[model samples]
Target chain A: MLKDMKELFKEQWEHHNLIFRMAKFEVKGMYQIHYLGSIWQFINPIIQVGIYFVVFGIGLRGGRPIDGDIPFLLWLLMGLIPWFFISPTMVQGSNSIYQKVNLVSKMNFPVSLLPTIRIVGNSFQFLALLVVLFIITLLYGIFPSVQLLQLPYYLLSMYMFLFAFTIWSSTIATLIRDYQNLLQSMMRMILYLSPILWDPMGDRVPDWLGNILKLNPFYYIIEGIRSSFLGGDWFFEDPIYLLYFWTLTFIMLYFGSRMHFRFRKDFVDYL
Target chain B: MAKVEFKNVSKVYDMYAKQSDKLLDLLSIRSKKSTKQFWALRDISFEVNDGETIGIVGLNGSGKSTISNILAQVIQPSSGEVTINGVTSLIAISAGLNNNLNGYENIDLKCMMHGLTVEEIEAVKPSIIDFADIGEHINQPVKNYSSGMRSRLGFAIAVHTDPDILIIDEALSVGDSTFANKCLLKMEEFKQQGKTIFFISHSAKQMKTFCDRVLWVHYGRLKNFGAKKRVLGNYVEFTEWFDQLSEEEKKKYKQNMLRKQYTVQEKTKRKQADKKNKWTAFGHLAMFIPLLVLGALIVLGY
Candidate 1:
């Protein structure tokens, strides 16, 4: 069994490029169905930003200020940018196996690659959103700083985090169909729990709750992006947080991979 | 040298009748219980060496699909082991290819699914396109294509994979006679190239022409497996005899067989089926209960 797992990993590694390309193909295939094509990727997120700004920034102006410096709209956009990256990737990633049940059953190939494809496909859309974010931020006078040089590192960390979580969700969701619904609810809860809309640092929450908030990987990731893009600080300055994020990412990846490898052969039977 | 093996394999499928039955069961509105367990295939064992073509001949629900599915690894056997030497491609033909994807993309995706690298897929793409011969329709989604076009594309993709073992389940029946002949020729070429092939069809003549060996599965058991001529000859005789039986004779035979196999529950089920007005009672209750309550309220109106 162990030997089989090792062989599976080796096969997955060798086929990683094919997996990535197929993932890109799946995204492209989605675009092929629509009249507007690739323009939707750019347009969708901007539309999301506009709707949220109107609803939350203007409509439900609850008089809650963000750090007393940043505009509420800007803060919401910053928060939403990461939330966009995380939510869809995780949700779609979780359901990918079930969605492609027929393909997995009929074909003999690496099954782990299916869920990973969801993450990679979503990453393309996320990149489009990033370009839109950059242009919007630039217009708002939130110019690039020296800390902007660490953007690549933050992006890498976020990708790693997304990949890890996707693997975890996809594997578990295969056995328990309800995990997809559970994940959506959890994401909604976490969206409010994390420092996405509110400033964790500025809030006078209890220290115990504050400490718990720091433990969420999204808190670090969203905060990491906010620091680099908004507050202008290098990501690597806090080695402890970086270590925590990487360690958690690796743990999720390891277990997720192990579950996938263990269950893949029997997947068709269940499907 | 054995390319495929099925040893004492059995698959039992638990079939639930429908949601209506379940709802009746939940509401204690039972007519006759409709759920049952069925053994699709049982104690099936066979072996085929490399470079041999074997054909499975059976009627519908005779476990032909179940055997093919097990060989394809699409579903696991309830018991026993199936061992194969190299990559096996089981093209149910109708089941695998996506109708939403265009022929070109379907080819690409199928190639990727079979573990072909992108460059390798690109190298073979032209030949596959040429073989499919649907011309400009290859660029359109497969849903728009005729069933013959779908078969052509499916056959093209399956052959291009260069499988060590090829399993075809009712694929050749779809295309026109010309395309079917072309497909048979391709299979002959693959057979000559020393690949193992399992062909499933209801046509006895086709099996006699194509296969070195014939396997007859009767109600999930291996009824016959040997040289094609002898096995098929016996199968043809048996089926002919079955067809010639008189209605009364067939009815008597069926009753005798059922009597031998039926359980006490089955007997009770038959009795219940004769006695029940379950649906009518439930329907009347559903229609009259509201009216009855309304009439009572009107009589006691405040």
Candidate 2:
């Protein structure tokens, strides 16, 4: 088992750099066709944020402050930043294998690399949104603290979780194409279900409901980020939750790797 | 040196019809209406040593692609195993390429797919671009490319990867004579470099020139695997006999195929119309299902 783990890790490392390059190429390729080009990456998301701020923040009265802490706009932006990272990462990642059926079948390389590329691409978009988040936070006078140093750890946790989920979804989607549609629906549900736009603490829901909400890995990630930036106490302070998150991530990673390795050989036949 | 071995390998495909067929089959309560198993390849075994250029020649549906796929590790044998000593690249030119991606991005993606790092891809990108020779259209989507352009780009990328085992599946035929010659030269260079090549092509002349050995497959069975001249000559003889069949014999052959493919009643109509137009028979048989159900019900007093 130790030897297997070592081999898997080595393979992952070798493929990771390739994934990164492909991801960058995909993002660049997307921009190449349009007249506006790479500017659209910045422009497109800003437009989306602007529309959300106007509709959800102002029009739907989401603009009003919630939890008597962060402004509604600021709260929405905070959640949106992570969601921006999570949703696209998951959705695109889920469909990544199916979309690249051609590459998966003909190439002898690891199939896990394709979904990794999708996650990496989404992460770049997340970084762009992070810039926007920083600008907004600076304007609001919510400056970074020593706790902000912990941002990398939180981001690492989020990355691990997203990677695990992407792998799981990519593998599952290859077997059952309906899983892609299911993923889109689930992501849409999670957008509202998770405490992205609303604070579960403020809503005062039943204990069982809140407990169930905690079961969501994204909930922990979002809470972890909120704790770091918003000065909220560490929601994941309990070593148990950290262990639980990591354990689940590892399990998913194992299953994902197994699925990719097992089914990869027959993918061309199906495709 | 790269070597590939398929030991006692077999592949069986479980053929399942759509949901409607299942529902109808269930309603009819017939076991015959259920799924079927097709063995595309069975108990096939072969080994190709390093630097051996083996040509595979076979009629359509003779498991040529299946064998190539297995060698490329694109598909596993249902039974037994395939072991490879080095990196294998399958030049399924059109199949592996993303039509939506431009030529440059496609090459980059292909490089990445072949397990090249970013820096490595960047370094080799210029050579791939120059070799493809598609001009500025390299920035355009590959879907817009003609078949020749796609083949050129694919061949260029595959050649640049420097694979230890290169498997080509009828991709060379897409390009013009000039480009095809370039591809052949590249294959020759790969052979000189001691790379294992499994080439599948219908062109007997090309295969004779390039391959040191030949594997002839017929109806998913290996007919011969030996020296190119001997095996290919035998394969040509077999095809010649098939081609010499009379029109009546051809009709009987097609009818036999239809019987194996369709239900009993559909087979009769297909056999009857085989002489006139086989396609018309298929059209009639396609519509015969509903009409047959009605006729059978009336005759049986259902």
Candidate 3:
């Protein structure tokens, strides 16, 4: 098992350049058919944020504030940016291997790199959305602080967690078509279940249940990014939650790499 | 040293009734075993020395493509040992070219996948384009290329990659005779450079002229393997005799050979069942062990 994990990492590391190049090509290809080209990446997210801001911020919250001083739109933007990155990645990453079976099967290509390519490809759009979030925050007079430096830490955490999850999910989805559908439904469920749209920490919800909801890994990420962007406690301040998140990630990675190496040789056969 | 050697190589494909059953069997949860198995290659073994141009002759569905895929490391055999000494490139029709990417982009991507440095790709770019002869269409998406044009680009990229073992699987059949002649000349140059080549083609005349040896595959088994003169002679004679048969007789002959290729013995079936049971049990264990460890660790609070 250790050897398999090592091999997976080493393969990705050795092919780092190729992965980046492919990711760039994929991001470009996604918008290639459109006359607008890559502009749609930003446009789609901005439109999503606008609708969510209208419905949840104005329609639901009555243009109120979240957690006292933070305006509802700013708070939603922080969570929505991360949520936007995570959502499509889950759907697309799970289908990455099956979608590229024709391309990868023709040569001695590393099938595992497909999910990473998906993540990195979506990161381009995520980065653009992130800049929009930063600009909006700055406009609201939230200057950069030491807490902002932790943004990278949270971003890396999100990437690692998503990588672990997608590696497992993509392998399962490739083997079982039903699982892909399950993943799509599950992502929709998670959007409502997690605190992206509604604040679990609000007065309407009880503290104990909200704490339990924080156990959801996405909750940890969304809350972490919110805290980093808006100036809150250091990530190290919450040792237990930190330990829990990384433990879950490594555990997922363990199972993912195990199943990946075991079944990847025959993945084409399944197709 | 032998450039390529296959020791008792065999490839068996499990026939799944449904995708759900495939998942269940993979997770070791399926109650009933799949009864259908296709043996694409059965206990076939051969060895090739450096610079040997070997031709494979077989009727359709005789597993010639399977051999090429395995040799190219694009697929793995079910059982046996395959030792390949160097990089193997399989140039089938539009094998690795991405249709959405332009011709130049496909060349860059495929060449990069083969580990060519940027400078090296640049160095070979002109020759590949010149050989493919697609002209201004090189900037156009590959989906726009005709079948012949696609194969030309594929062939050009594979040959320029400088693989040690080149397997051409009917890629020449798509192009015109002029391009075919050009490829044959390039292949002769490869032979002079001592690179082993595996050629799979239906044209016996071309095989006779190009290959040093011939491998005759008859329904997943090696019917003959020897110098081109003897093996090609026997293959050509057999093909001629088989063609003279009535259509019904030919169909019956093919069905009989196919039946022999796919049936598994009761002993092997039982063995495979036991192995599946063990794997399923392991799958259950693997599924739970991680959650168990994670829960335990969280409880312990690191």
Candidate 2 stretches with Cα past 4 Å from truth are A1-8, A60-62, A203-208, A235-244, B18-35, B98-102, B116-130, B192-194, B246-248, B251-302
The Cα local distance difference test for each model comes to: 0.77, 0.76, 0.86
- Can you list each candidate's DockQ? 0.13, 0.16, 0.41
**TM match of model 2 to true structure:** 0.82
Which of 2 and 3 is ahead in DockQ?
3
Ranking by DockQ: 3, 2, 1
Q: C-alpha displacement of A157 in model 3, angstroms?
A: 0.8
| Consecutive 10-residue window with the lowest summed lDDT within model 2 chain A | A1-10
lDDT of 2 by residue, B193-240 (tens): 888899999899999999999998766667789999999999888778
In the range A47-88, model 3's lDDT, one tens digit per residue, is 988998999999999999998888998888888888989999
TM-score of chain B of 2: 0.77
lDDT (Cα, tens digit) per residue for candidate 3, span B140-245: 8888989889989989998999888999999999999999999999999999998999999999999999999999888899899999999999988999999999
Model 1 steric clash pairs: none
For A115-146, candidate 1 gives per-residue lDDT tens digits of: 77887787777777777778878888888877
Ranking by lDDT: 3, 1, 2
The C-alpha RMSD in Å for every predicted model, in order, reads 13.1, 13.5, 3.3
